[model samples]
Target: MSALILFDFDGTLADTAPDLAAAANRQRTRKGLEPMAYEALRPVASQGARGLLRVALGLRPGDPDYEPTRLQFLEDYAAGSTVHSKLFPGIEALLSDIRRRGLSWGIVTNKVTYLTLPIVEYLDLTRESAVLVCGDTTAHSKPHPLPLQHAAREAGFSVERCVYVGDDLRDIQAAHAAGMPAVAAAYGYVGEDDNITTWEAETCAHSSTELWSAIEPLLPSDLR
Candidate 1:
């Protein structure tokens, strides 16, 4: 079977933090709070709504207003899905490299279909990605193995033939659980406290360029 490259949507494959942070800041503004700086909200971008709400409004899942805040955040994010979103630098080259090798790539994200679909379409990735497993696509999300396993299966790869790349610790955890090698995208929304190297990924890439270099050696001889 061909090797499959599965990437996390928000941070690894694409930089969606600017828009996600804006959505969180919008929520803060509605509550009479000041807008948070993009850098301040960036690290939480990988965590989705839960992280954004906490950073901007200090709301947790159990809070009475949390659900309303979350709904609003989703609405705000959708309205500006493409504002500052773009594939990470060097990613285009990396993807082209993968395509030239005749291998396959897909996305497995905690982003729900509502959010994931628009970004995927906006970025024109719909045609190129062989398979997509959104947050809601499976009953469980990462750090559960289900999403990665589901995407790999859809991509016609055994878990052992897959390599999952992401910016979060959960990504590595899930990859290991699914018996796939994990590559950490340290260039992405890594938290201030996160030690990317400690996640025990097969490799840690500090930038898109580094990521490609790190992953290239891992591909089998035929694909390389």
Candidate 2:
């Protein structure tokens, strides 16, 4: 049997924080808000634009300007989508290794379908992904079992045979909630104050190489 691997797109499989931060800055500049550095934005990259806008522009969700700022951020992000987005180092090697081992991998993300499709295409990863689940594909997103369960169903695997790898607390929560094992991606944009050790996961991988190593032991015997 082939073990199913589900990955998060933004911070886990791709280094999209820079481009996201740039978009945030663009919106901030337009709003006369201070431009925040990419480093400062990295930790909140997986939280989506609302969280980022709040962090960068000091706007709360209930604020009257929040929606306008979010819309502006979306426009800015769309304009700069491919400018600085790229896969993390050694990711290609890790994917190749998985292919070589005959394991199937998929992506489950809370990112909107429009942005997710283009980014996957831009990275030349569409052909490589066995399954792709976007935020709006179903009624619920991550932290809800719907997305991961949906991915497993589409990939023809039992949830128990799958492992979901992601960079955020919600990822682990969702995977576990879905009855699947989880892997925490340590190299992702998690903050210094974040408690990775508290996240419930089968294992943690600090880099692409380490991820591959950790995954190797879990590969189905058929592949070995």
Candidate 3:
């Protein structure tokens, strides 16, 4: 089977922080609170509503307002998900190179299907991706091996022939659990306090420009 490269959607494959930050800011505005700075919110974009809400309003899941707020945040985000979202710089060329090398690529993300589908379609990735596995696609999400494992099966690849790239620590953990090499996207929404080196990925790409070099070494020798 062909070698497969799986990427995490938000932060990794796409710069989705602008829209996500806007959604969180909208929540603050409605409550007479000032919007937080984009820089403050950007780092937590990979965490989705949970992280955004916490930073935006000091709210947590068990709080009474958290559930409703989370739902509204998602609704607001879904409406503007693609307004500023786009492939990271050099990502298009990276994908092209992967395709030219006969490697299959797909997305495995914690984003639920409804949210992910629209953005994928907007970005014109719907037809090109060999597989699209979302948070709801499997029994468990990242940090759990099911989603990555499922993507491998759907794309007709063995775990050994797959490499997963993402911007979150959980992504590396999931890849490890699935027996796949992992590449960390350091240029993505990594938290200010996070140390990329501590993620223990096979390699860390500091920017989209560096991704290919970081990934090349992880590929099977035959594929290289």
**Among these predicted structures, which one has the highest TM-score?**
3
Q: Poorest 10 consecutive residues of model 2 by lDDT?
A: 215-224
With a 3 Å backbone cut-off (N, CA, C), the pairs that clash in candidate 1 are none
lDDT of 2 by residue, 1-224 (tens): 77888899998999999899998888878867778887888999998897798789887788999988888889889888888999998988888777776778999999999888998999999887889999999899999999999999998998977888999999999999999878899999798888998997778998866887766655455654
Assess each prediction's global lDDT (C-alpha) against the native.
Answer: 0.89, 0.87, 0.94
Please write out the lDDT profile of model 1 over residues 81-187, one tens digit for every residue.
89999999888888877877788899999889988898899888888888999999999999999999999888888887778899999999999999988899999
Estimate TM-scores for all models.
0.96, 0.95, 0.98
Which of the predicted structures, 1 or 3, would earn the higher lDDT when compared with the native?
3
How well does candidate 2 score on lDDT at residue 214? 68
What's the best-to-worst order under lDDT?
3, 1, 2
Please identify model 2 stretches exceeding 4 Å from their true place: 219-224
Worst 10 residues of 3 by lDDT: 121-130
Better candidate by TM-score, 2 or 3: 3
